[model samples]
Target: MLTKSSQSVATIKAEDASKNCILVFDPDKTHAGKLNAILDFLGYDLLLAHSREELAHQLKKYPGLLTIIITGDLSETEQQDIVNIVAREAEHILPVVLYSVPAKNEQPVSLRYPPSWVAVKYPIAHQEFSSALDRVHAHFAHQQTEKGQRPAHLFRSLIGRSPAMQHIRHEIEQVGPTDATVLILGESGTGKEVVARNLHYHSRRRGKAFVPVNCGAIPRDLLESELFGHEKGAFTGALTAREGRFSLASGGTLFLDEIGEMPMDMQVKLLRVLEERTFERVGGSKTIKADVRIVAATNCNLEQMVADGTFREDLFYRLEVFPINLPPLRERVEDLPLLIAQLNDRMEYEKHFSVRFSPDAVSILSGYSWPGNVRELANLIERLGIKFPNGLVEVNDLPMKYRSGTGDGVSHDSQLDFFAEAAAAVRSQPFAVKTKPTVAQILANGQDMKSYVSEVEKNLISQALEETDGVIAHAAKLLGLRRTTLTEKMRKYGLQRPREGRATG
Candidate 1:
């Protein structure tokens, strides 16, 4: 018989145990020794706990423990106590195996245990114990796989660890399985379509098609026909009957991007379809069932549009059943490091080369207000990858606007000082010519010097606005220009900031 003193004497500290270590609780020294020999022969690490107190201590010390194994004579109450401790402290549900013999005059050992726990007859054959251990190992392996699995829609996209992103992910998981209409609202380039795709992939309609149509991109006259099919001879170019996006996306999802840009007349028709779950072809009177989940996205404020009588209130309400607002890149600046790493990994995969950004480079990039959001960041990263495929990108390696923070709201004197600092940093490092052309090369390539200079000036001004987060006075100071002069230039270049909302980060 396994004695408590013998079992307790061999107790192993949970902190020193390996990740694959198993917690074995068996008070009987004989049974514990037998199981220990079996496990040790199999090259498994074991942590023996003789009592509830020891078990609790081991659990607290090793939150990353793999599984638990209990053998010998364990009362039902003791078993319950062990399970309670495992369930309460474990990061995830752990598989537990209980081996026990029937007591005198008692019924056969019951297999009754928690879903995560398995009970087996004690004094079992070595083969049976081996099989049980195999099952436990398999269960642990499966759990590890599940922990690492990403949502199908999240493959190669939608990367972030911020609270806002985490909340968005939770909302997607909650709403993706339903057939309700989802309205996604965010600024432009905020990956609204990505969210829609994620919803479709996670929903029951994943196997079917995912048809996306940008309402703003399509001509107003053809928008209706694009959404609903047209019959033969429906219009000037209707040579044959053709299925619309709704028909193409039947039994799946239809992502309506920039829904706010739809015309008022089209909005009424859309509202009717949403209400009835059916639509008629543009040139045909036959009503067709949509059978497609609607996911609408917009950068415009639909409520404000409704107040202005531009967007139909009924359609807005129908689309807003489950609204998900995506935060812009500037709002989640803390996630920049992860985003940069992911972006660079993608670049390396595609280009067969990689570049590491220096601390200063990262600082400059993170400090800027990403007005264009993730899309702009992706573009900038790709540009860098193309320019320097495999090299350390330092502060001076960054663009002038980024290095000097010319758009980040520093005073004129401060901006000048930063420029001096940037120039010194650049001078300290050896200059390396990039594959891209210089301004002199462009001039020699027969490009108009005046137009080229004007374009460069315009780009500088745009970067300034972006860095200053669209603060006109701050941008003017960064550019060392008067507010009126900056305003005039902004007007000349047709640069306008969108209406402000609640700032984050």
Candidate 2:
């Protein structure tokens, strides 16, 4: 039994606990394990509640845990107990997804359910599981955002918690207010455009439009007309007068992507516009005021281009006023978990689909150079959602370039329980005994303290070794045990590190 909270019931902040903390209860451990595997891979924090008391305790402890999943058959008494406990949680209301076998031909809807509870038939399909998650996510996003309870600048589109991401976000806030010519530098697919949009959203002109034009994508001959608009009969294809990117941006932002690829003639013209804030329409003498903030982005070396006499020096200096450099994905590998979580959330919320990458799979991805940057990572996430839709993606599941480690051409599918699976996946915790074994479940089964502690120790050491691919130093670091101590423990337990291609407990 757990000690109960004596603190008076009071209002709780939704952001009190970490986001996406899901608490689940199921009498059938196997079903719970399956959910654990799915939820962990999908990038959620899963906490198993052993009893009604434990469930209530966790809800009160983690107010950010807004979603509760209760599975298996609940007796009328047990159901009432859970309802009362949840109702007592006055601080934050929690949504419940209940899975129960329908007696005879009775439908799930025919049964009585508590407030904030929805029932799924006994045999829950992948689709229903995803739908349940969507409902909870939608409720949280819509309600919290509508009430203004959530921060205005949470910036779901710009996902990261790493220091690098924090610095970038801070930079956006600092430079977003200025009207200076901004140059965004990053490798292709590193989200230069995404940063530009963030700049626009935070600017005073957010209410206005944000126009993006790929300067390199447009033809060299027509680039002038595209930037400054053209009068009717200006060119062979110009049938009528039209607003160019400058006119369309009209007091907002003009994001010039691949600006390095602009012809030298256009660079000279662009520099004049930057210096004078005015440009004449092609084949028209009218000088239109360029009421737009210039935001140019490119993966090329503009400085080198200037030295090579390909790009104009004046234009290079003009666009370099406020440079924002985006670091490549490989440099900030720590942000992978958050990025994957955000991507998975997008897929689930939009398509009613969800998937997860095994800890080993994520570890393997971390080792890659990520030449394509975040775009490549996003594409891979989408591909996994399509390929293994609504399931787990193990190391072997990844494409050839990403495949490595002991998982190569190997399968450990039927080996460990979901408990070990999650602990291995977590980078923060080398081993997390999410829910400690209760005295009743252990002592009542004729277990003693000495044996229990040793057993638990052996299991954790085994799991850490397996997760680190039987590497002694790595496993020791994960277990927080010195190499000598871990080796001694292995000897005491009659255990030995498995071979490179295979691991066992």
Candidate 3:
């Protein structure tokens, strides 16, 4: 039994006892002293108590006692009460013995219980007590070993410990154990397939296959046959009967990627399959029962599609019985480091050359919005490994497009000219083909608008340069022009002379 406070009703000195041994009992002061001394002399360690109440409370604090020696003889009902407490409340397996002082006339009283414990009288052989204690310790050790050897497949594969990930993990935990339909919503390049895999692996259908089908990839005429299978000769090219994703995944999970892209007519067929758990192959008479689980994902606004009548509202609700929404990479920028580390590990395991991203490289990465999220990051890292194998990827090593903010490394001048030319095209469109010109237009009709446009560009460029502290790169950003374009314009307008005085442009 566990030790209670020092102010226990009856206390023992607690001398040299094996770590595996404990003694619990209720005894009068005189009897308690005698019992403690005898047990000490006999090499038996003891934990004492004033009553059954104290003993039961102590048991909660310590676990696994080899033997318990209950000291005085109580009534049969009282003895059974103590036994019940030990059987139900003990932390781990502990063999128990009821010890009583030698009786005046006949044999001492003994109580019986299940095989888990033992009952013995006092003045018993020392060897008998020690042997029973050893047995209790062995039982607990064996049980712990068995528990440690269970398989890893019992849990899902998605791994992250951050608070944001924890919330996502908890949501997955709640639904992964059930058979409910799942809907995953996120922007493109987020790992929707990974989440779907986690849901399938953690569910009761783990051992079965996970079939993923992209609805947008198939043409309208072929999509129905692709999803629902088809009988022989259903179409011109149909030479034999074929099983659709639903039938193929009958005992597992079917993940529909970009389900919002599925045609409206096909949506009706899908709803029927979900509602009835049965479907008919194209040109087939028999309706086949399907036991497949559904895991659908989309980056589109499904509610808006439903509202616009492009998607069936009932089908949308059925697919969205449970939803898991993923945050965009920009919102979870803190996760970038961990994600990069994980990606690096994967690259190494694939036998790719080792690489490292410079601190400045990471800083640049963090500043961007990651329009494509994790998938885009993964691709970037893989590309870096391939391009700069066995080397450090400094900020300068980054592709020029990414560093320049265009994502395609086009020359700064070319980007500016593209935008300026596009603006010019819109301005030059015929505004009035047959309308008569006003007197002011007749007077100025011969003047070129080109000079006026150049003057407007010059004034805006000078203001942007002043606002940016004369940093041409920053000025270009402010004016939505490339740095090179801004420099060229500054020269054309005689504004590029070295600034020796305060800017007055």
Q: Which candidate is the best by TM-score?
A: 2
**Weakest lDDT window of 10 consecutive positions for candidate 3:** 424-433
lDDT of residue 187 for candidate 2: 96
TM-score of each: 0.53, 0.61, 0.50
Once superposed on the true structure, which residue ranges of model 2 sit more than 4 Å away at CA?
Answer: 1-156, 405-422, 425-505
Q: Between which residue pairs do clashes occur in model 3?
A: 401-409
Model 1: weakest 10-residue lDDT segment is 424-433
Model 2 RMSD to the real structure?
11.9
> CA shift at 494, candidate 2, in angstroms?
42
**Residue pairs clashing, model 2:** 41-356
Off by more than 4 A, model 1: 1-154, 406-505
Model 1: per-residue Cα lDDT over 306-372, one tens digit each = 9999988888889999999999775565456557655665555445555556534655665566668
Estimate the lDDT of model 3.
0.64
- Estimate the TM-score for candidate 3: 0.50
